[model samples]
Target: MTFAVAMYNLYDKPISNVKVVKTIPDDFSDPVIRETTEGRGEVEDNKIVWTIDKLIPEETVLMKFTCSIMVTDITKRRTGPIEVTYKANSSFAGGLAIDKYDAYTRNKFYVDTVERDEEPGVWDCKLVFENPSEFILQLFNADVYSPEDESEKFVDIDPKDVSLLPAGAQWHSNKWRYESEELPAFRKKLEFRVMPDFQTNVNGTISISDVILEIASITGGMSYDLTQVPTYKEQDVIAKLKIINNGSAPLNEIAINQQYFTSEFNPPNASEVTMIWDGDEVDLPSNSVKFDSNVFRISLKNLRNSDTGLFMPESILEFEYPIHCVNPVKEATFESEITYLANTFPLSQELEFRPEVPIIEALHLRRKFRIGKEVIPIGALGKYQIILTLENIGTAPLQNVVLMDKVPDNFEYGSYSGGKPQITDEVGEDTLKWTIDLLNADDKVEISYEISGTGEYSPSDAQLGL
Candidate 1:
């Protein structure tokens, strides 16, 4: 087969309004290549032109040129999209020649063309050349594989590991067993691009969406009480992570692998407490995550006084996780704090009742008595009546009483008329005692005593001295 090359200007014309101001080099043989314009041009003039080269031999050839144009609205202060397509006839057979066996030659065929439109937004470009001969056709794009950092391809992360993503496109590998016509053979590479404009949109839309590798959080820390720093009940604290959506697209299924440690806990009710989560892997939400301040909680029992739990005050939590950046998985490490909590009670119970006096009272008493003119002679038998009155003078009632008096030598016992009294006590000192069973908080009791004495003497001479 003979090879003949020809150049065609998509943005150019032979006559007036349309013309190809730019062209690819004639010596260039690559079917898929990138060429930039020296300067921008107005649409009316169509100054910029894309040059096409024909590498196949034939009578007539067809070429497809595609690119996205970005249009700026100076008044609106924003950019839009406009896609451009150019097809022209060439004096050759088929299109550009591509070597199927060469990986480098085939990869150079992928290209993404962009443009701005006045009405809509930017137009994304995907150019497909249908008219194919024996030669292969392809597109050219930037290399997805990084030569400097090989570790950027695969990584392992623990549960507590949290990764902050950079602004750009992010991708993670998914095992797809199915086959497709576009890619007849399986390709292992995952491609991602972080465009600045796309990053700006993500930052504006998301609050704190980022990648997170959550292991577990802690509610209690190292604390001491009267006992041997009683270990708190082991509670599974929700591991929280902070992630920033720095990329153009959201990240999903951020796998966090956590190596959980067996915990020792001292419960207030018992001596030991512990718990475990069944799985080693956890999946994060769809959005790019931000910082999470919540704690993952776990129930524990049989806590001990001398032991510690997986999450405790001042406890250190460390783990790793796989990260998605620029479409590949990388390893990231996360470190956090775990805390513990202790309970307490009062030493004494509350009082219900107390003993106390309700009330008190005081009493004062004075009396005077006189003898009337009715005596016959000294030592004469005579009957007389004595009047007496009583009053309440104390807080309590008095009962079971008896009356007694120390009469003079001329006095004798007379029949007294009133309520009878019962004597309760009599002492050798000639004193009498009375007892009363009924008493109130502030009530009083009263009693009286009476006696009579007589002597045969005139008023001037009191009774004979005795």
Candidate 2:
């Protein structure tokens, strides 16, 4: 496939030092470069780089590349993330900030005075200028005269010779010493200028938008007969996947690939599948939405040159369909995963998601009880060992569970494992109950207790309430 990547000078001013670095996808073959508009196109470091001297306003530069594909069952090809950089004549993408005239004059000027111990009563001094702004300073001239006598000149910097001061920098004058009993003072007059803002007559700019590709993720759960599945023997189960575009990049070339494990599930027809994004129903492209015995695919945008996508950035999309239970005779643990391919067209980049699919499963629960009764003297005394085990064998944890077991009277409760369960003695039977507050799916708990009475103890089956 051959696609055109172009850069347009949108501003009214000219731009210079243009550099474009277009990264070719790994899946595509080495690009076959075609003729460019004006700049030179070279392949360097596995990148197609195009650089131009300048671009006039409204001028566009285009480059074309032809890449072949392997044409497998389903393939994804990307063309971006392209990097374009250029400097406009007199502008910045982050907005311009030109300081006021007074701010440029923010500087400091002072004279250093040091007393000489070697020569008593003599003092040395130097004149300095400190620039605190970001512009270069031009020092014109400075004159220092003795305050005691107006005609006595101490320091003189010529006005004809201009001195340059670096930005946020300082300048110092030659040192001079004065012989006087008291601290000597001088009068000074200075002249300098601050560099002014720039002004030019340039016209035109060519700053191409750099491609920012972020892989869109589908984050939502499957909704079906989760808690109310047991209400009907056979019914149509609905599966839904929700997606929200949380990033700034719009979603395009969207397609869904879903897998079903068993043949007992009857996938809905292509026409029956419903897709909605931003409250508008989306129509699947013809001959692209396919349903197989165990898998199905819904293509929102056609695989070739999709003009529009499923949803824009900050939008929501929902894909829902019905799955008929072909056989509801046996216990079913329905599990399936749905993942989506979100891509940006033209300057194509994509993110593949492999997160676990939402599953509706019947968590494993085993409730069992064991009894050991001992009889003494053929019938006089009896002893019993009751053990109840509860195991949660699922990925998620199990909540509350109440275990109830009834034992006949005359059997005194002995030691119990973990802790003794609640005991309530009735007339002819004693209800031995254990309330398990929580049980992690990866753990198991066992309750063992011994009882001795007059006759062989028969314990009823342990029951669970969830």
Candidate 3:
């Protein structure tokens, strides 16, 4: 059978340095090179290689070769598919691109014979011929033969009559009935052959869709204490971006641009912002500059596909810098945009940034002591009253607030007021624990306890564990 391999340039621009490689099946032998359209190709060790300098847009390169199928046993005979890989360099699309194609002889034309039913002495068989190729197949002749029985003759199709089979079309033969004393087991001896017009060009269309790119950003460490307004004061702030190619085609000539505005509240230098690509430090693009010496523009490039000839689903780029803001600010914003060339078309995605402020505040714990109506004396030994206050001065509510207060060594355990406190007395010290389910903003809880001084007590001897 003669096989025609074709490579079509689906891109609009001309492709240079074209290389086509084809691998033949093991069952086929003695490949005879018939012709090539643009370049010479030869079969080397069961593989064919063709090199063309350039291929114009919409141009197709065709290579023809002939190989015969060796059938030792009809039931055990099988052939593998022909695999082809092509690569070309496009100037407009930035560097090399690759594509693969597989062609199977079985996919082109095949026949199947199955036994429908079998009675005591009769057998019914059905034969079907299928054309699965994209182009029309001109079937010259087809025949079924049974060599075991002399009564069963060979069914021959007229060679002069040509049958045109459309793409994805099937042809069924008339059911054949065989009568015998025993059931017909037509498994090993049944054989079929099909002769089709093989020198014609099999045409098909190739569609190259536009590339689709999605970009997302996540800001880290954007929280602040509610006691003061959110400020960026020599603190590290990170912006993580996830760029992905969600299209069928590869994207190239990629560039990412981010503009960071620095005012009196945020005075981050352009050099201070370090750009990391896939965990490696990379130099910024030429277009990156510090506009007006305050507004910085960060540009990155060469974000293309990997060696596997496909773009990665996600490419992470992180920008980290130290923010120096002396005064508090309501908010800070930045803008980022990604531009790339996909299928020879320019595409871009822009993202608006609004830094997030986490709802977290600093917890305050105050401890004070008094004796009767006045503050505790320096060396008083009477009963002393200890006051503990836990306040939540943040913008958000605090959950699961546990306050642990340790009593002094010389103080004796006493009853507490205002809140129920779990007291655990150890050998040397005692612990007073208070649990609050929720503490809203500006809310405070005070717990007071009276303890008698058993030994010589001083102000420095009293230590509050919070």
User: How do the residues 1-466 of candidate 1 rate in per-residue lDDT, one tens digit apiece?
Assistant: 0111223233222211222232222222223323222212322222223332322223222233223322232121111112233333332433445344322211212323334344243433332212122223221121222234555322222323322223221222222122222322211232222212111111011111221212121221121111111122222222232222122221221122122122221111111112222222333222312223232222222223213322232222222222111111112111223333221111111111111211111122122222122222333334333333233344334443333322233444344344344433233222323344443434434433333445752232212111
CA lDDT, every model vs. true structure: 0.26, 0.65, 0.51
TM-score of each prediction: 0.18, 0.33, 0.32
Error of 2 at 339 (Å): 5.8
Model 3, 1-466: lDDT tens digits are: 5556677788666665555555666767888888899878877887766667777989988888777765443233233334443344433444434354334344333334344454556666555667776655555555555647645544445534546667787766566776666544442222223323223222222332322222222222232223223343423334343343433333443333333434433434666666665567766543553444444345433444323233333444455554344433445432222222222123332223343333221222332322121224333456667777777766556677767676676667566687778776532457777777887777777777776777675534555445
- Residue 450 miss distance in model 3 (angstroms): 3.9
1-466 in candidate 2: lDDT tens per residue?
A: 5657788888787788788887766666767778799788887756788888888999988887776655442223344567777776555433645666653467788889888978888888899888887777788877788886768777777755546776878878889987888877789877778766554434333344444334343444445645223222455678777776655556566677778656555667877788776787867555767877667887766434453434566777787888765544345666776777776654353555554555554333333332233222222345556667777766455566766666555456667676777766532357777787887766777777666664554433222111
Candidate 3: residue 459 lDDT (0-100)? 39
Whole-structure CA lDDT of model 2: 0.65
Error of 2 at 192 (Å): 92
Instruction: Name the candidate that leads on lDDT.
Output: 2
Q: Cα deviation of 369 in candidate 2 (Å)?
A: 7.9
Off by over 4 Å in 2: 1-253, 259-295, 299-310, 316-418, 422-428, 435-466
